[model samples]
Target chain A: MNAPPMLEARGITRLLGEPPVQVQALKGVTLSLQPGELTLLMGPSGSGKTTLLSIFGCILAPTEGELKIAGKSTKGMTAEQLAELRRSSIGFIFQAYNLFPTLTAEENVMLALDVRRKAVTNPRQTAREALINVGLGHRLKSYPSKLSGGERQRVSIARSLIGDPSIILADEPTAALDGVNGKAVMELLSKISLDTSRSVFVVTHDSRILPFADRIVRIEDGNIVSDVRQKRA
Target chain B: MVYTLALRNFIHDRISLIVTLVGIVFSVVLMAIQIGLYYGSQQVITGMIDHSNAQLWITPIGAQSFDDSAFLKGGEKYAALSRPGVASATDVAVNIMAWKRADGGQQAVVLVGTDSDDKSLMAWNLIEGSVADMYKPNAVIADKAYLADLQVKGVGESGEVNGRKAVIVAITDHIRSFTTLPYLFTTLSRAREFMQLGPNQSGFVIVRVKPDASVAAVRADLQKNLRDVDVLTNEEFRDRSVHHWLFATGAGAALIAGAVLGLIVGVVVVAQTLYASTKDHLNEFATLRALGASAGYIHRVILVQAVLSAIIGYLIGMAEAFAVNWATRDTQLVMLITPGLALALFLITLTMCIFSAIAAIVKVTRIDPAMVFSR
Candidate 1:
């Protein structure tokens, strides 16, 4: 029998704005994400791709429907509970490479571990190991301001991976980078998804990096238009 | 690590941090100077009672304060000395008189008359000349703070005091009065001569207890034996004097109002600066929240920043206040900052910063994690 999906969203709908201007950002969107799969969410600007990613990451509560992470239903959870769940089960990467400008590369990664409030026997060692995995060992002590765009994003990726969460969510992870650096980041995400205990979700409209996705789901007007699986090259 | 985040953020934005620190420093200095002036004035109000070596005071009935004591009849000193536990008793006469300056103007002076034989009950901080100088006929000791006001060159300068020819034989330091009257020390006989009063009359009687005697017991004995008069311990008289100047006359209320105004201004400035800083960094805080940081954690970061600002600002302010105090040490307007006052001001600065940080904290706590997504 197959393993349970790492993330599952069923008939989730989200409404935005007040009366007289109410808009639906997502509607009856059902999706399942398996471990060791690199899934890409692609759509136009107002197609609710970002909103769907937010719901999947637990950053926003669904207006109606059930969502589960690691087989636990996230229905009726408080904001604080949802935050705690995110800390333990999800890692997020943004397109801006949002590393704290004042913190060093290693320190940025250590912040993730610190937020988890887990018993970290040697945080410095863990941070250094994460940075090394992202090929930033030589730049461990460099601040984001002193780093190149690619280096900063690597630090951000190191930050996301430091917590060893079950799923990684990347929102336009390569939109700010040049083609060479963007492909490099996508390759890294692909490698991370190959680990059977982990899953990667990328939300982007950039079709140039489509070859890296193991599964591509297209969204339009608050609905899922297509879901396709492609064999890895 | 959380504190490190706060420290780093503070250091990263050096310009804004320094600006906020300036606001805090301004507040601290303003409060310190105002409060210090209030304390200095209080000190001056009880200066005579505080400096006297006597353990008890005997005054006319209904004597409300040291400066406003009613005259005691002749032989009151001897009567006090005859009581048990009263080892020594001396006459003291305190009367506000006029000193005729060389410029043909008169300045109000607080004339303090003590027994000629008991020098210890007189001005103890003589900076120029000795207490023996007051024993000379028509001799009076004036505070150095009144050199320009009284228009006297120095010791040995002759002036008219209360319409009597008197020589300023000694100059004492810090013998000031809260009423802005310069203190003039003299022998009881000379004071009587200056005031043109009967030889036996005095304003109060200073009583000293024996080394082994309990001052409280001595005070009670004196109170009982002295009919139609009030007997008070030294501390009681000092408090009475301070209370009269502080609350009874409304001077204390005015000074306190000034200090409180300074505090309010400081809090407002600090609150505005910190709120602006937090608003500038709202995006970063939201990002942290999206990354699973708890509200409690973010609150700690802001509090740490405020406390750090308070500490730095307090140090700079204290240094500035001390410099001002030192620069004005010899002036009529006394600025006194005691260690206790310094500590209290430091706590006030911390409280001010914390109060100011509340505005920032509220803004931070309201930041939605969804903000990071839109950005």
Candidate 2:
């Protein structure tokens, strides 16, 4: 039997803003992100790409429809419950490399377990191991301000990988990097997906990284325009 | 790691953090000084009553404060002594007298006179001579703080009180009263002679209750028997005196109002700085939320930061306040920071900072975690 999709959204609709000025950012968008696949959500500004990513990341709840993670429905869950599920089943990567400048790379990665509210045994070792997996073993003690953009992004990726969640949601992960750095980051992400059987959903407009994605989904005006599977470089 | 992050954020930027710390310290010190000044003023206003060991006091009827009293009816001590709970009763005299300065200037002085053997009311902190020296002929004790006002350089300098010949036999320090006038200490009879009152006349009577007697019962007996005088326990008299000079008079009202205003201003200042410091890290807070941090976790982080700031700020602030208190110990502006007051200030600071974190909390809770996706 085929395994269920790691992250799936059905008829996801979201309204932004207040009455008389509300924005229908998403309308009946359905997508399934599978294990061992790097899926890219591509669209222009105001095209509901981030909104869809936010709903999938459990950061925002849809106005209608359901989000299922590992075949478990996320309907009627409180914000805190959604947060718990987000920590346990999903990982997030921001475009700005949102590592706390005050915290060193290792501490930033360990923050994942801190949010879990569960007693983690030797979390430092776990965080160190994750950073090592991301090729940042030598930069464990470096703060975000002390590291370059690529290194900071890598630290962020390490932070997302800390809990080994089934789904990883990345928003413009390579938007701030140069060609060489972006290529290296995409190659690393592609390798992570192929090696770990974890679903990696990337929301980006950077077409340069398209060669590394297993599938490409294009969106416009809050609707999916095209979706195609591709071969990696 | 949470505490480490909080502390790191607190100490991250030396200049801005120093500025914030300076603001916190300034608010704390301001509040301490204001409160201390009010407390010191109240203490000075009731110094005689507080220092006295008398179990009960007999002042003329309608006496508002120790400084504001009429002469007691004659035979007050005898009436008090005849009371059932009375152990011993002694007459005392208190009146503001004119001091003939050696500078050919005139200064008003409050002369407090009890028995030379009276331990109830006596000169304290005598730096130059013993209290026994108060028994010497024409001898009186004067505080060195007002030595210049008394127009004398030091002890043994002769001065005149109400045109009577008196000599300073001892020097004291910080023996000031509410009226901001110098106090001269001498024997009760000597003071009576200086004032030229009748032989049996005294301003008030100091009564001590028997060891087996309850002060309240003794006070009731003395009040019932002494018909022309108001009998009160020492604590009652001290409180009455403090109430009169602390909240009754115009100066007293002004001082209390000033202290309260200072405290409010201090709260605003500390709150603003604390809120600004929290707001300074909004981006990081949003980032944490985007990283799947729970609301409670974010709350803990912010509150931890506030608590850290409050504790550090309170310590440094109180240290500065104590330094100022010590610096002004010999001066007229005495700052009293009791242990109770210190604890209160600490709790107030901590509570204010924690409340200040609420603004940041509300903002962070409403932040769109998806902003991390946008430019």
TM-scores, in order shown? 0.92, 0.94
- On residues B198-281, what C-alpha lDDT tens digit does candidate 2 reach at each position? 777788888998899999888877777768788887888888888777777666677657656645654565566656766777
Top candidate by TM-score: 2
CAPRI category for model 2: medium
Candidate 2 Cα outliers beyond 4 Å, as residue runs: A195-197, A231-233, B13-15
* Residue B194 CA displacement from its true place in model 1, Å: 1.9
lDDT of 2 by residue, A1-233 (tens): 17679988999999999999999999989999989889999999999998999999888899999999988889999877887788888888889888888889999888776875547689999899989988899999998999988888888888887778889889899999998888878887898888455999999989999999989999999999999999877
The alpha-carbon deviation from the true structure for residue A122 of candidate 1, after best TM-score superposition, in angstroms, is 4.4
> Over the full model, what C-alpha lDDT does candidate 1 score relative to the true structure?
0.86
User: How far does residue B188 in candidate 1 sit from its true spot (Å)?
Assistant: 2.0
How do the residues A85-149 of candidate 1 rate in per-residue lDDT, one tens digit apiece?
A: 88888888988877787789888888888987767789989999999998889999998899987
DockQ of candidates 1 onward, in order? 0.63, 0.70
What TM-score quantifies how close candidate 2 is to the native fold? 0.94
Please provide, for model 1 over B344-375, each residue's C-alpha lDDT reduced to its tens digit, 9 standing for 90 to 100.
Answer: 99999999999999999999988878777775
